[model samples]
Target: MRDSFDPSASEIETTTAEEGKTRKRPRPGERRLQILQVLAEMLQNPKGERVTTAALAAKIQVSEAALYRHFASKAQMFEGLISFIEQTVFGLINQINQKEESGLAQARGILQMLLFFAEKNPGMTRVLLGDALLQEDDRLQERITQVLDRVETSLKQALRIAQTQGGTWANVSQDEVSIRAAMLMSYVLGRWHRFARSGFKKLPTEASDISLRILLSE
Candidate 1:
């Protein structure tokens, strides 16, 4: 449940209270988005500490009850972030699958985008690496694992296509494709860790093209 500037979270309007005082409040859906945005911003910290609902409520300038008005609980807020990641990443994957022809190219593009997206959204990178969900509900971690598994499956599919099309591998079996896809996913995860651990100083895409070339060559 971590990431970047959401344009939609910008200040919308202020409403006058019954006492004739103007108070600022996020517009309807915007509050929910703002809550997620702040949660993500807090998670981007290099410490990778568990964020408590009290702290999250404080960050949003709202009472705990106010926070609950938008989300049932803190876990649900994390789920919101997870849902955002799944939709955003998979939507892009669908496009890559639709437009890309070469299996190798599809795999490469997916990996590159994975790193690029992380590089740009460091907070979300923390969630992707499970650094932000260490102490939260175990289910959040499982959801992240499932997302990565799907990514690996997509990679395996692309690799199998490459093998069928020829010029990608020499008699590589389906098991081997799974293995390599897992390895590629591992590499991406490692890069994400480095990016987060290095206080976001290290870019995930540093020499990424050359690195992918070497890895894919195997």
Candidate 2:
């Protein structure tokens, strides 16, 4: 399993030397990625202030007009981050489903993956919990909510598999499977919220093993 998220080497900026002078320029699509990367880093601030375009542009050493050249608006930049979150997460979920045979084990793996992702990416944690989007566009928050709902759906599928496999959850009803999935989703979100709210001092995976054992136990 991947332990951390990082941009590809190709996405990083590079410099070219010409005529005794070195000039740094981002490759095609690199500046757009750099913008998103800086934004995520700024969000790591524990203060949790709304990230403004001015601050973002200043951090990137680019004018506001330059940022607009890559992204039409601040919301589009956020959408870029959100898209990263969705792709990284769902891609992993598909992997877990493919490798894990037991349904309960799948659920456990998914939950652990989520916590680990948040613990590793503090800035993205705020994005996951919607704290970073509080004052931003309502559509941004809505998109996050949709991502969360999809996560819950994945959990439900795993629980349903466990329920059918004749084990501790063999007798669990369909409705009960749904309820359990929701509870697990809530737990994951609560951990993320605490981690972000505490200025990243509180790790999401702190004591998660014991907690998951209890949560997954009959």
For model 1, the stretches where C-alpha displacement exceeds 4 angstroms are 1-5, 8-10, 15-21, 168-170
Off by over 4 Å in 2: 1-21
Q: Pick the candidate with the highest lDDT.
A: 2
lDDT digits (tens) for residues 1-218 of candidate 2: 45434557335444556765454677788789888888998999999998999999999888999999999889999999899899999999999999998999999999999999999888899898888888788999999999999999999999889988897799888888888999999999999999988999999999999999999998
Candidate 1: which pairs clash? 2-123, 2-124
Question: On residues 4-114, what C-alpha lDDT tens digit does candidate 1 reach at each position?
Answer: 456565665766788886767666788888888888888888777788889999987889998899999888998998898998888888888898998888999899989
Question: lDDT of each prediction vs. the true structure?
Answer: 0.86, 0.90
The total number of steric clashes, by the backbone 3 Å criterion, in model 1 comes to 2
Which clashing pairs does model 2 show? none
TM-score of each: 0.91, 0.93
